[model samples]
Target: MWYFLMSDAFTFGAFLISYGTIRFSVNHWADPNQVFNAFPFAGHANLPLAFVSLMTFILIFSSVTMVLAVHEGHKMNRKGVEKYMILTIIGGLAFLGCQAWEWTHMITGDHTVLVDGVLQTMGTTVTNNPWGVAADPGAITAALQKTPDANLAAIVHSLGHGGTADAHATLGRDQMISTIQAANLHVTTPGPIAFGGYFFGITGFHGFHVFSGVVINVIMYLKTKFGHFDQRGHYEMIEKAGLYWHFVDLVWVFVFLCFYLV
Candidate 1:
């Protein structure tokens, strides 16, 4: 915190300045509501946004458990540490699971009650949806809309932004690059540089930290039971892990703000 507040003005300040500058610059950036428009089981729930929000909540809950685990460890309460540690593990695992589901839905695509925003037609397409609704050609056609021309350029353009009539709703080449990568993640996998840029850059890095914290807590759990820290002998491990856990949660909070909420 001190480093950011005073020490490295050029390094940290440069980053903060850059982020703010870009944010200010995107006057026509995609609308969060429109970009995340989705349809879930109940018929096109706003899911992407919902998942991000849920992930945020899950991380926060995990933080609570992590803190409790550390507090108990400090008091030399092995059983208490064990309990809170278990809760922390469960929360971490749950977050990972949710992230897995979120990534899966993105690549496969999803259907929604939305239809061109204004049209609101119940369109469906295998190429478009994560679920690939019933094989009704009408629904698929209304959504997929393959290019009329057989040329690569046509296909590319049709999918590319500002393409032809057949490709209006399609993602452009540059935008579509990450589509495939999104399908293969364990938790928010990297999808091309754009998707991967944020995926691996932010979430992946955060996950790595989580992985390390889990390792520490697991050690703490075992030693705790074996009498190494029984009766609250060694609470330092928990405190250290808590610090790392808090950092992880803190990063997610920022991620939710910059990547999702904002």
Candidate 2:
């Protein structure tokens, strides 16, 4: 396990180093603050890094529980090991849930951008970056001129208007276009295409590690429940599993720093 972890560390290190190189080479990269400034169930609230911080906390706490489980294993305390292992599994599952929501939010988000002298709505994806540099006032005005009435109305509705969908549907095209112009909604030029690739590749890789760790913990929990460790006269398996869990947590600290903080 130690050898495997060492090799894994080098892989992650190389990925991060390459990401940093590309990021610095670019004239404009997406701002983490603007990109991650969202919270679940909080409409349009700019809470940057809030959800990610919660995920970090949960993973770290799970590492603590894994340590406790290992300590108990040293003393052949089956019940203690079982309890801590269960907690660790729960934490891993919670982190996965949070990640799923974040991915869904990013992929499904409605962002307006100026493309080919016309305004179009898009979302973040491997080939698209919705969180690019904001378009200038002149560009926005020109794009608005070319924008279709239905697209204009969709943009206006995305700006959090209080009208019901039925009522909005009844409104005329001119009214919708006027509403959009009055609101002065900002659009962006697409960011570096590599940004989405790196973000998803690295974070998705880390999420897989977390998921693997959760599965290992679940198996460990079942083994403890069946008195497998007690029958063996030692709990080395639990200790080894704990080592893997801790390594997963440590890697996340760097992942969070690279993708979210730096």
Q: Write the per-residue lDDT of candidate 1 for residues 49-104, one digit (tens) a residue.
A: 77567778888998999888887876777789889988888888777776666555
What would the C-alpha RMSD of candidate 2 be, to one decimal place?
1.7
lDDT of each: 0.53, 0.87
Candidate 2: tens digits of C-alpha lDDT, residues 1-262? 8999999999989999999999999999988888888899998999999999999999999999999999999999999999999999999999999999998888877788888888877778889888778898798887787887666666766778776434665687677667777877768888899998998998898899999889999999999999999999999999899988998899899989988997
* Poorest stretch of ten by lDDT in candidate 2: 161-170
Report the Cα lDDT for residue 2, model 1.
Answer: 34
Report RMSD (Å) for each prediction in the order shown: 11.8, 1.7
